[model samples]
Target: MATILYARVSTSEQTLSHQQTQAEAAGFTFDHVLADHGVSGVAVKMKDRPEGRRLFDMLRPGDTLVVRWVDRLGRNYEDVTDTIREFMRRGVTIRTIINGMVFDGQAKDPMSAAVRDALVGFMAAMAQAQAEATKEAQKAGIAAAKAKGGEEGGVYRGRKPSFTADQVAAVRDLLGKGLGVAEVSRSTGLSRQTIYRIKDDPAGASKALEVWA
Candidate 1:
């Protein structure tokens, strides 16, 4: 009966911390959080993903599943609708941070049931449509960039990382303890994305710090 937050961190603009903050701002708190980094929510089915599969086995009746939105639950309309219905059938409450939408299967009234099901279908359709649109937009952006020219400055080394050498060590320590990204972010006063970068490549992060210094 634990409240779990499941997030997919793929975009550079919206990292795991942003999702956690958004959920917190909506007055939602979780006992545990699971995230899948670098996984495309638009292309991959939820159950096929690593942490996504864990959500199926880890969640029990009376437990609550929180996501940033319906789109975070699946890759397509059918997938999202099916996942939500299955969870509701198992008496698991699903919540969205976007509009504070709640889907429960315990409703005895037919009218309430109809409304809930309708909303689910509509949101799932919208999620699929949104994913398609985003894909097309990315394609266009790439085409436009190619038409313009190649990189002006040979190879671009990204901006300097936010963490110091000591901070990187601290991040590694917390990560070794199996702490969640959000928890590590809070404990070390570092951004969740930074923690993720370090977790993925500790030595490279250390080298980057030295190079910038």
Candidate 2:
């Protein structure tokens, strides 16, 4: 009956860490936390993600799973609803930080079940809508950035990385030792995305000052 928090970080600079902080501040405590980094919640299915599969395996009957929101479960409405229903079927209690909401399967009454299902569907739809909105916003932002970059003397300066050289090296070392990205993030204070960026392309991800000289 452990209380676990699952979070997803799409990039190193993302504020996913605040999910945990906010939960704690809201008087919620977790015995463990599982996170997936550098992974798009919009595109990736929860079960396919590295840490996400781990979560499915680790949780047991009577355990509580806490997420910042239902969207963290998945982006697709069908996928999110299915996952939540499966968890509830397993006697797992799912909670959200945004509204401090809980979805439980303990209610045997037909009306209670109907209400729960309806609410779950609503949340899942919202999650899917949010994901689509985010993708559109990202496309607009990139277009804007490109327009600015093309201006005279305006080099296309990329966003600065959040990790340091030493941190990158440490992450590389950990990956070399076969440590999983989530574990590395927990052990090194580096976001899973940052660690994966280093793992995928150490040289490219280096924080070298080589934008425009």
lDDT, each prediction: 0.84, 0.84
Clashing pairs in 1: none
RMSD of each: 5.6, 3.5
- Quote the positional error of residue 28 for candidate 1 in Å: 1.8
TM-score of each: 0.69, 0.78
Once model 1 is optimally superposed onto the true structure by TM-score, how far is the C-alpha of residue 132 displaced, in angstroms?
0.9
lDDT per residue (tens digit) for residues 35-138 in model 2: 88777776788899988999999989999999988877877898899899999999999999998899988989999999999999999999889879988998
lDDT of 1 at 44: 80
**Pairs clashing in candidate 2?**
none
Candidate 2 ranges beyond 4 A from true positions: 15-17, 151-155, 161-191, 201-213
Q: Model 1, range 36-89, lDDT digits (tens) per residue?
A: 876667678889878899999998999999999987786688888899999999
Global lDDT of model 2 = 0.84
